[model samples]
Target: MADKKNRYNIRDHAATYWENSPKWRRVSMSIAFIAFFYALPFLNNPLVNTPGSDFQSVLFYPVGMYVLMAIGLNIVVGKSGLLDLGYVAFFAIGAYTMAILGTHTALNFWEILPIGIALSMVAGVLLGTPTLRLRGDYLAIVTLGFGEIVRIVAVNIEAIGGPRGIAGIPTPPDLFKAKFTILDPKPYYWVLLTFTLLVIWMVRRMAARRPGRAWDAIRQDDDVAQLMGVNTLKYKVWAFVLGAAVAGAGGVLYASQILSIVPDQFNLNVSILILACVVFGGIGNLWGVILGAALLAFTPERIRFLSQPRILVFGIALVVMMNLRPDGILPKKKREHFDPNWKSVEESGEGEIK
Candidate 1:
């Protein structure tokens, strides 16, 4: 009876200690971080305009797009280590699909979003199926060419409005049916923020799972991954599909926000900018990519006083990042290993036997 009572006391103490301790502290910190994120648009300095409350909307849009693009690229370049130069192709396809579908049919922005995503998935699979068989620089070149093809088609296709591009895309209406209209972008800001968070969460989940692990192994060495029974082709195609889907979602949101679309909007330069964000942020780190995206998206606008020199500064920033911190702003931590353990395992002739 005494032992049972003592055991109950121990369990109670443990529970009480946890309740009063750092576990709660960590949870509180997480809640604070989330609050901070939601409040960021509301907290603005002089460089960003917030006079009429539109600044919050303006700021959130850029950040949201960058976050979305970074997440998409994270799947391809970060998880799978695919050096794709044509990722913007998926973005263009999504935006254009949303534009055409919404504009041509009576279907509204909300209705067209799912269709846009489907189109992006199909495009991803179509492009990835053929190119996943290639490797290294060859894959990059092929993807680059594919991107150019997409842009060229957008430019030349008359039914899609050709080089002039499509304009007058409708914005998403208030779904809540508020009696009063929301002229301010605050509502849209929240919507985009929610969308961005959802995408980030999804990307993080994928990165923590078997799919992400398989892609990482394939990234390290396709031959070794295949020997380990990882379906290299299956995972590669999935990476492409998932990455394209995210990009497509971004495109739909962006087109709706801007209410305009141009072939130039989905050009080679866009791809480079997104790739720059991914590399600058830390290839394997989602949070790092978010930081990188924010910097890339907002830096020039903040330094508009520099005028044309902003491009020079941007170029310098990239050059310095490569030379000074080649691993990126948030590099992966080096994994520690026991030397004797490695030697013993190696000496066991396990690898040789295989």
Candidate 2:
């Protein structure tokens, strides 16, 4: 085993620019992010401003949504050390719940958010309660199947538009005189960005507390965690539930922005892609995930002139990375004895082995 002092180092190892950023600079950067998309439409970027072009907005909105999904999934796959291949199931549940309720009834976007989130949380519990006991690849396979099952159900359900999908999801209410129309995507972008920020804040805050420690403990070794009096099952379930809530929120944003959704959108590939962001960004590292999500989401579009396969390229990148930097561009780190519960060997009366 590695030395207990060095096992989980959460120290900052960011590039000089980021590591050296002062508090004022950090705050300024955040403000820029909040206004990034909302100001894009006014900018004279031909790629997006050119008439009949919705490409840029479309590309960015989905990226924002997926970023949220990646954040949520990181809680399970990275923090809790649980491999969840069926996370898109929650995404689908949230999207469909909102789509059905918002379209059929008079429910506005704000009104539908809670219901969609609740449904997704319920779905998470339904899956987690029965499967949290499974470990390793077994849990992964079950999750993969769960995602498929949700999509299959969506395909057959006529009330939710079957294979055709639900459409004409009402746009969110207006802000003063401005509205979130299809052409004016700035408002929609801001909404997604705000949600993404909130999820990031919440996840970071949680990671500083007992819940975060419990998650890391379970991730390191469930047996040892249980021995330390951590209720492994409960914490594991909470991980799924919280992750599901985030994914559900993503779904709500996505469905509202696109104004429609089909069963095909939330598939296993989506789950794999989000997981890739987590792994590529270095699992268990929050900032790493954010950087990875942005890079992976945007690079393909930037390289479109090459006309290469995105997934194929992604697969190759993963292969190369595994052979080189498996810890990722920014691997997770933690303080020595950050959590009081994880005592040093010397403290536990187990001296160093010679």
Candidate 3:
């Protein structure tokens, strides 16, 4: 009976099969999956490509960028249980950094990349230090305000082009004789893919180590974690800083690809969309979050024929999804099981307490 039950449990069976597989086989399968994504642009499948838009460009912007941002935001909202509504601020900081330096200075993309990330990290630290103490809705509100503040500041500062935004942002240097131009978005897609993979690798490693454990503890119960000497504040700050750094890198890539950026581009809606991706995908589950981001990002472009009503359709779909799976499409798996009270069972005459 137990064997039959175990065999019929698809999730358990699949998990066990993957776990028991040879390391080499697992590595090969992962490589193949990644290779498939890398070849996606070349596939040119009518079903996968958007009807009215450039498939590669769409992949680079909403698809690639959204996936990257979702992963970052997942660390905060999903792992650390932090509600950050101002996540777009870090993204804007990174984008503006690249735009300002790329236009005003002789620094190349590679050089300015670190500067953008560093500044974003600094911003994270500044915002997180005092604000990390607040929990739940309070933190979210502060972050939301922070995001708006950044945008408003950008609009008022005419030196940074204000509402007009900065233009002529130089693209990355030619890589292996392939020029990074607007006409061909494949190179940009490839670059973004490489960074996305790198971020995934790093995040996975972090999730498996002490920091990941710390986040899990914090997420489960911040008060208990602090009582257990987990230094919740430090971990919370770390999560914020790391998430900001990822956003910053994404901003740099975005600016280089578009060659122009406006304050409006990094608005509150961007943060909300990224948050929705994280929520719709599966919160702390890494692959679930990635899948969610890609699907949500691609859906609008795919259904452009619906025109203005497409948004209504999208909203309806989200509502349906939430109703069906409130936890998310690929919610994080839980290992804990409920243990029934033997005394209650005895009183109910359901079973004997052996």
Q: Scored by CA lDDT, what does every candidate get?
A: 0.76, 0.79, 0.87
Candidate 2 lDDT tens digits, 56-85: 574445556667788999999999988999
Could you tell me every candidate's TM-score relative to the true structure?
0.84, 0.84, 0.92
What RMSD does each model have against the real structure?
Answer: 9.5, 5.8, 6.1
Clashes of each: 0, 5, 0
Q: Which ten residues in a row are the worst by lDDT in model 1? A: 1-10
lDDT of the structure predicted as candidate 2: 0.79
User: What's the lDDT for residue 186 in model 3?
Assistant: 89
Q: Where is model 3 poorest over a 10-residue stretch in terms of lDDT?
A: 1-10
The TM-score measured for candidate 1 stands at: 0.84
Clashing pairs in 2: 8-334, 9-333, 9-334, 10-333, 10-334
Stretches of candidate 2 off by over 4 Å are: 1-11, 15-55, 334-354
Worst 10 residues of 2 by lDDT: 345-354
**What C-alpha lDDT does candidate 1 achieve relative to the native structure?**
0.76
Winning model by lDDT: 3
Enumerate residue pairs that collide in model 3. Answer: none
Which of the predicted structures, 1 or 3, would earn the higher TM-score when compared with the native? 3
Question: Which stretches in model 1 have alpha-carbon errors above 4 Å?
Answer: 1-22, 47-54, 177-183, 336-354
lDDT of 3 by residue, 80-143 (tens): 8888999999999999999999999999998999999999999999999999988667889999
